[model samples]
Target: MKIVSLRVNGAGQAFIARPGTTLLLALREQLGLTGAKRGCAQGACGSCTVLLDGQPVVSCLVPAVTVDGAEIATIEGLADGQVLSDVQQAFLDGFATQCGFCTPGMIMSAEALLDRNPDPTRDEVNEAISGNVCRCTGYEPIVSAVLDAAARRRSRAGEGAKL
Candidate 1:
């Protein structure tokens, strides 16, 4: 077993994992963070998406050891003290989720897109979440949620609100 240290959801975390262990497995089985789903374990599905250093990544495709020293953000870390992030709230308000299995990954992907481009166009939003396959929401609500979240973020920033 190898000991890896990384920042998870704004907190420092360490875990002992085998060399071939995927990040998804490490997060779920080792760290007890089940937010990253175990969808297509081959990375074809975006259900296991997470943010690695603020970039959306397929956790199932990434080896746990490869994330050493990187900052990993899971859906569990998006909220603070019972307050949901703007993107999460938008998803809820827009009814973007259906079965909820894809919500975590979709949210993380949307968060990464917004982090880089707070005001993304519809095409960009679609491109950002393209990897995530939501069989339930049919992609319309998800797109709307991202756009709504971006607008909300801009409004909050205009008011000098801190994220």
Candidate 2:
């Protein structure tokens, strides 16, 4: 096993990674961060999505060793104590989650989207989360949630609120 270090959720983390260990596996098994699920292991499903260096990536397809010293952000890091991020709050308020299997990935994708584009059109939001798939609560709710989240973020920015 090789030791891999990464900055996750703004904290430094280190864990042993066996050969061929994917970032998803290391996050779930090694670091005990199970927010990113292993839905398809094949990277077809965005269930294992996370931010690597501020860009969204399918964690299941990235080898742990290849990303040593990278900055990673998972769903677990989206909340500030009990306060949820704009995307997360929008998802909850908009009733965008059902079964919740795809919530984390969807939220991560939305987070990346808003980070780059504070105000996004519906088409842009759809394109941002195109990689993620939600079996329940069709795309409408998810899309609406993303749009709502964008508004929330903009409002917060106007108020000088911190995310």
lDDT for every model? 0.93, 0.93
TM-score, candidate number 2: 0.96
How far is each candidate from the true structure, as Cα RMSD in Å? 1.7, 1.9
* Candidate 1 Cα misplacement greater than 4 A, ranges: 161-163
Candidate 2 local lDDT, 1-163, one digit each (tens) = 7888889999999988899999999999988999999999998889999999999999999999988899999999989999999899999999999999999999999999999999999999989988898888888999999999999888978888653
Displacement of the residue 94 alpha carbon in candidate 1, Å: 0.8
- Candidate 2 colliding pairs, count: 0
Error of 1 at 95 (Å): 0.6
Location of the lowest summed lDDT over 10 successive residues in candidate 1: 154-163
Q: How well does each candidate superpose onto the true structure, as a TM-score?
A: 0.96, 0.96
